[model samples]
Target: MTHTLLEGKKGLIVGIANEQSIAWGCARIMRDAGATLAVSYLNEKAKPFVQPLAERVEAPIFMPLDVRSEEQMQSLFQKIEKEWGRLDFLIHSIAFAPKADLHGRVVDSSVGGFTQAMDISCHSLMRLAKGAEPLMRDGGSILTMSYYGAQKVVSNYNMMGPVKAALESSVAYLAVELGPAKIRVNALSPGPIATRAASGLSDLDNLLSVAEGKSPLRHLIDLEDVGNLAAFLASDRARAITGGVHYVDCGYEVVD
Candidate 1:
């Protein structure tokens, strides 16, 4: 049954690659919760895959946004301002690192690779928040995806561990910085699951198996699990919450 948790709310969802994306999960849930959404696809290559999903949710403002491009980023917010006037929440679920760097030891990661990873994975959230600040005239929540590796050494997670560490840290700092404006920032760290992005990790099968076995729930989590938490955080129900690293890891984060 759909609810009105987000009735009359407008949100922007970034980083949907396909049906299995965490962003798509959040978008689907948020839409069902009565949110009006504006979605972004990375580029033409991704548009075909993402456009259909956006339509399924009835997104009225669908555009291309490469976080690396200031032009595109600016255009996105401009369009949002023109169409929606204000934004109630934003979901950032994008991350990237060169394959060679990702599959190698973090210590061996090249300066270029690490920098790119940090820029796309961590700094982009800051940029998006900056753009969303003015549009959030009535306070808003900004949610970004993070992982357990940000805190612990997950064997093959590599440089992303540090990148995500920075992301979580940014969430804390941003929470304090934007608190006066009533803009909330938080990180959602979900346990391992198969996504097009996660497939980049070496021995992902092993990682999934280990998480399922070790987690208190004895199974890996699905996209809806993450979506439900994301929907709550985006709603007024969580107005008092911010600067937190909330986990939807099936109690896995609690397991030693």
Candidate 2:
């Protein structure tokens, strides 16, 4: 049984590539919990895939946002301000790196590739937090997706390990900066769940298999499992929590 935990809450979800995306999972659960959501797609190529999911969740603001493009981001927030008046929460679920860099040894990664990954995966949260601060008049929760690889070395995880480490660290810093304003910032570190993002990684199946076997539950987590946790963090039930990396990995992080 689910509860209306986010009734009257408004949030923006910035990455929904497809139905299998972790961003989509968080959007679905938050909407089901009675939160009003505004969702975004990367570009025209992605809109067809994301529109139906946005519609399914009844998102009122469906816009295009490429974080690298300040114009697009400004337009998105302008729309939100005009339509919703304020934002209660935001979910940053976007990350990327050149395929060559992702599959190669981090030591050999190109400067361009490493910089791009850090910009997209880590610094974007800081950008969003800056944009969201003013609109969060009543204070709110901000969530960004992360992985175990951020803290521990995982085979085939490659450059993302360092990229996510920076993201988790930013969450802590943002939490402190926004605490006085009552805004909470957090990173949701989930075990590998075979999302579109993970598909880019090498030996994804092996990663999943290893995680399932090592987890205390002996099974990997799914999209909905992550969604359930995300919904909690976004709601008032987690009001006391802020500036931390919350794991939804079924104890996989605890294993030796």
What residue runs in model 1 are displaced by over 4 Å at the alpha carbon? none
TM-score of each: 0.99, 0.99
Model 1 scores what on Cα lDDT?
0.96
lDDT of 2 by residue, 50-139 (tens): 999999999999999999989998899999999989999999999999999999999999999999999999898999888889899999
TM-score between candidate 1 and the true structure: 0.99
| Range of the 10 consecutive residues with the lowest summed lDDT in candidate 1 | 1-10
1-256: candidate 1 lDDT, tens digit per residue: 2589999999999999999999999999999999999999999999999999999999999999999999999999999999989999999999999999999998899999999999999999999999999999999999999999999999999899999999999999999999999999999999998999999999999999989999988999999988899999999999999999999987889988
Query: lDDT (CA) for every model shown?
Result: 0.96, 0.93
RMSD of 1: 0.7
> Candidate 2 regions off by >4 Å?
none
